[model samples]
Target: MSDDEFTPRLGKSKGEDGKRLVKYGGRVLAAARLAGSKTGVLTRRFDGSRIGRGASIGRLLSSRDRLAGFRARRAIVKTRLVRMAGNGFAAARAHLRYIQRDGVTREGAPGALYGRETDLADGKEFLERCRDDRHQFRFIVSAEDGAEYPDLKPYIRRLMAQAEHDLGTRLDWVAVDHFNTDQPHTHVMLRGVDDRGKNLVIAREYIAHGFRERAAELATLDLGPRTDREIQQRLRRDVEQERLTAIDRRLLRRMDAARITSPAHNDPFQQAVATGRLRKLGAMGLAANLGAGRWRLADGLEDTLRRMGERGDIIRLMQRELTARRLERAPADRVIEGELNAPIIGRVIQRGFSDEHRDRHYLIVDGIDGRVHHLDIGRAAATEPTPEGAIVRIAPRSASARDVDRTIAEIARENGGRYSVALHLRHDPSASQAFAETHVRRLEAMRRAGAVERLSDGGWDIAADHVERAAAFETRQLRDRPVAIEMLSAAPLERLHGADAATWLDHAIASSEPLVLRDAGFGRDLRDALAARRQWLVEQELAEAEGGGVRMKRNAIALLQRRELLRVAGEIGSELGKDYVEAADGARIEGRLTRRLELTSGRHALVERSREFTLVPWRPVMERHVGKPVAGIMRSEGIHWQLGRGRGGPQIS
Candidate 1:
């Protein structure tokens, strides 16, 4: 690839002849997967030129006649490429792969550009030459970040111009207008022949191989006494040094003036809209707000606001909530006042929450004393308040229920029928029995081998032989299991006295379904993915390393699943674990532990890792819960969720 691949689009529209004018909107979508010919089963074509959407870009320019002639010339070149090669996706992929490998034409075909086709006769000859080519190649180059992101495009353009200058020819830009995804990528196409039908040769894998060195080389150079003031100077000098054309300068100026449109700092919509304003509208907002400050408010945003009576910057969220509604949800034709959420309650609504985050179903209460509180809707929905016995933990997914019941029963027996025993009334009786079986096997072996004795009341009376047997069993199991499987094998057990599965969770971080981050800009996709993964990590009680930044240890994950530990390495507070994982991708499926046993040292014996496909570093958490949350501890406010009329973030620890 010269510096990029050729991803050209051919379109046309009526020249404001106002009558059915059409023009080409250029660009194509491209994806590449090497070794595997098929992109995936969902893909429509094998050779790979599939245009899912055919809305042409030429329609806009048809409404403006001034740019017609220039567009026509470009359209002609595009048509020729379409005839000889494939559609945008295939051509773009081929071009990108070719450029990276340094595409160079040998004998046949007119070069990607055609200045020599001055006459109809020569153009016909040129088309013939292009059609006869036998070999095709690919190249790829990417700015590890993105071309449109902070200070990257200018650097890339310089590289392209250098390649063009070195080859003594203008590089054909084919993939510039690819429309679908905002990858900030491009493809340039070329042939061995130049405008004169002479031979052309270009380097291969040039982008990654060449630019890798180039980026480093540029990183050096003591631009001396660097400071914030010097940054602008360097940028200006770089643009000028590369001899940017007047058109390029105009584009950069327009981009520099663009504004963003969201609460998130790196909003993709802001970026996408800037591109549209640049390509279609010609200009955008003034410089975007980078510093911490207020957003110019829109209308109709007050419907969601309510005072939580906590202390933080959330007081200002009401204004933003109102503004967003006016911009996105309110009927555009109707002019409205402060949004529905903006109450007269003298506080700034600064907590930026979504409509869903704010849209909670209220309990619809009739309160005395003229006061109202939302109360936890989830808990209220599932639980009935009663003047009854206290709540306790249950472990049915574990085998401990049986052992626990036995312990309680024996205690009762020893007391000679004092108080009735009820250990977590809801856990299935079978699960409790299963838990006892696991412990019983080890105990029976020790007694039979003359190493220990079982008390008449079912307690262990052990000796050295019993200890020796446990040590042997644990060592054998560890040696047999691969490191990763052994790490993820045990499932965490949580004993919730009377609480159902749903009520015991940290509702903010735990959910049954997946979600997509929504945004008009492309970042919405990434944001959602990150949020879900982050939630999972948090629920697993896995926090990033503390001050020392230790690599999360594997053993900690096992301990958490075993429910023997709660808090991971550096986080505060221990917690009960409710975790489950497959031993390997194709290994035996993991069923809920209807038969339970305490997950402790020497357990996890049944998890099997296949002889092949070694498990890599699997995702797991290390949590050690000493006991449930201390009463009155402020709830976590990290998650933005709704409970009745209220919306709040989990309080930070």
Candidate 2:
């Protein structure tokens, strides 16, 4: 054929659509071969019958049948995606500090942060790099047999290396190994951005399955594939375990529509394991035998078993703490979980994170009710640092709208949905200026929370559903702070007897409804302390003997508080070589808030002048103004703090 004949050309005749069509002549194959030789093979044909290559294909294959054949090594991976909006970065910083907090090491030192190359990693540097990132990735990876490895860094580095290859991006991450828990684990924090300064979007499928599979692969590599003997041993161990186990999961998956299962697997080993597990579950009331080989699993069996496992862990923790303290309490007296009828007045026995990965904290309190109770106090940052041996009052946080919210709503309703301190006072003429200012503070808090709007005219724009918004705001707050914790006394019960401070024991003695004490544990100890304190009060002429009980003189608590304040002030004055001045009620005080003093009376702020200093009652508002100038008036109720643009500025009651 000639070259002209081999060339492609449009047909002379048009199609029915009036568009010319290209007709490939028989010599077109020769032209294509000539073009292919010039351009090199444009594309190669892939085998449609075989599985494709790449990480995604491997992930799909693994996710579908990952646990088949030999028992795969178990690794628990918990993940959280935190958006770094508003104060989220601040919370992330706090989480880093918490993970590196003291007593997390094998020798009870702080946890050490490390990266791929170094044994010591700077958490601040990592956070600084992530400061502008849109979000962050947090993960807790725990291998079931992690303790078998001496250090987790090697395994974690390998896992992350595999992840980087799988995700096709370089991950900026830092991790801290925690030996504090029963199972050694690593907390890995990956920045949201990739190497090219772009937001790293990980596939949800990869996060859900691929990452865990990678961890299992690494673990299995290090520990070798599970032997038949090892697999049988683990299965045997799971038969009587209270927690949800693999056997239980298998049985659950195999159950018929009637929720009936039978130990009749083709594999004799699995059948025996299932039968043994069912009998154990039957004893635990989680399963019922239907005679023969059939068994009926209970409704909510998974939840019941999970809860049982948690309760068992809690009891073990409680017993461990109590034994460490050398304190003896009957198991019957131990209260792990319950609703508090009244506030729990107790000396803190121990306080630590319950779920370290989530930063959830717990407290073991020795209550005056004669019971040792364990309380889950939610997030660590939500509550103040409660030192061990401090006396505290824990009450359930109310989610309903406060009376202040109702008052603000009522006032705003009459004033065209606008509320101000002036409007609050005008609405309720009988309300004190200080009381009305309290409502303004409440409004300021709500405004900061975006539940209400603050206008330029020093007023709040309240919506019609203001009360509901306030309730919802409080409900959101409950996620972080589940309960209200008040530090009644910073001192322990043993130190309160002879001390000059006005302790909780003194208040308990003066109250009409005294705490009912049992003759056991902290109750008996508190009773003795109260007796010694009463004797000390008599010596100080603050109380007198009266019919088997001492009668407290007028203002005994105030007197004791004043005594301690004077003593502490004198010491502070001597240290600074400055005179100590006491501020009188209605006196206008102006100076710098130097530091805070936690007196037995209450928390007081030390206001320092050029020549003299005075200890004034501290308000929560003053915390942000520490080391800054403050001007306020000492009132009968409390200090009336004046903050910001003169009188028009914010006034905290």
Candidate 3:
């Protein structure tokens, strides 16, 4: 039979129709078998069957024993998954450096990095390996009894080995054990890639529960199971503690509809502990005795307690820092929480991480307001490092819409809810291109935050409520960076009085408004320093006494700034054997940024060429580019820095 003759058609004979039905049934059966195999594979993968039996077993045991009466050894594990894109690599490098910073060791030396086999691991080599990684995993593991172990290295190694076995893959990781805090802990940085160079995908349950359980298991084995006496002692301590404790968590869990009944316990110690904790809670106004052995939990009890705990920590930190510096202030003079109605001019007493794992930083400031203030300045990278004793101004970051946002909204409204540099310029012909570009940058930031939309044509699809959206975006940013810190002087007040440069005191003198200073702490010192600075300026003929006040010359600030710059430039020129040239406005500056010099005027960068060098205003963005070739135009507001080579380089204003 011919092929065409055998082909099935609508009017085909019964034999052809049977053949077609049989062929179609076979295809359908094959498809069904394939689908069944895929479903089976997915089921095995997700049903805790293929993800290693050890991890599954560990998770089961952890959940089972969580509510058991006996207290096991505890471990706190904080994990963060960081995506390595854009500036992520730089941030990762910074984090590595931060974790291995000095004074983290038991002997007050720098923290030493280690790997699975070696006691000393090269952090740079590890970073090089992680350069091309898609993401990274950072973990901070702290055993409650970590100090019991003579050394934490072995424990950390064993814990990591357990994790590797549970995950069924070799992990590329390094760790550093820090003994600086009361609770000794280890910081582990794991590469995102597995042994076979594949992206490591850990289950959420594993990261959240399995890993901590594994650590706790290792700790329990090393320290032995917590004895009844140890458990009771810890529980008793928690009962009277100001912080959130295990007993509070138990009470919260036992509550029915925000009311908990104090039931008789089989263990008298536990009953006493529970009763004591409830009474403590009542004293703190977190629980109300509803009578009949019942207590009503207050709304926001957890939040209030957490805040109280944080305040207590802040107070302790302030006390420790002040005592170390030999500075004394009354407990009532310490400000833990308050609204900063005005910018605080102060000396930074101490700078440290409030939450080290999250890189949240805080500052203890001896303010000119005559109070010691603890300010949560947010992210570590949000502000430039203001060293201890440096004078700074701390101001609340405004969440309201700025003038740039209003300008963008107005221009977008005029152009049918579309914004671009071209539209901005067209809307206001008098505005400079640089000014218009600022609006585009604002829109770009909002677009990245997902608060606004960007068109394919490189324009923003501005909404009618764009201003409100801008405000909302800033409000979200405030959670990460709540305050703006400006370094007024790198030198202390005592040193700035005799300095030749135009200092913060000079700026204060030039201002029309008078500074309000109290006669205590930093405030008293600042008043004396200002008096000395005014006397020095008068000695230099830059100021004159008039009407019981020191009056600065018409161009006193300019003259002082120029004098200091000249003196510094002369010194730098002598060292490099190169002539010093002053960069004028609109001057094309091309040279390598050699170093940074912090003067009373401001931070300045020394850019050196073959024959000559110039000092330009320094920017934080230039920090990473130090020793690299830099080109910029000195502008009236600031230098427009062209970072990197080629036409597509980033520009910073």
Each prediction's whole-model lDDT (CA): 0.28, 0.85, 0.85
Question: Where does candidate 2 clash, by residue pair?
Answer: none
Candidate 2 per-residue C-alpha lDDT over 403-447 given as tens digits, one digit per residue, 9 for 90 to 100 = 999988898899999888888888889988789889888877777
**TM-scores of all models?**
0.17, 0.89, 0.86
Off by over 4 Å in 1: 1-130, 133-141, 144-158, 177-183, 195-199, 205-208, 211-653
Runs in model 3 deviating more than 4 A are: 1-55, 67-71, 338-341, 412-469, 635-637, 640-653
lDDT of 3 at 138: 97
Q: Which stretches of candidate 2 lie over 4 Å from their true place?
A: 1-66, 644-649
Highest-scoring model, TM-score: 2
Query: Among all windows of ten consecutive residues in candidate 2, which has the lowest summed lDDT?
Result: 46-55
| Residue 29 error, candidate 2, Å | 36
Q: Which wins on TM-score, candidate 2 or candidate 3?
A: 2
* Backbone atom clashes (below 3 Å) for every candidate: 96, 0, 0
Q: Give the TM-score of candidate 3.
A: 0.86
Q: Positional deviation of 370 in candidate 1, in angstroms?
A: 45
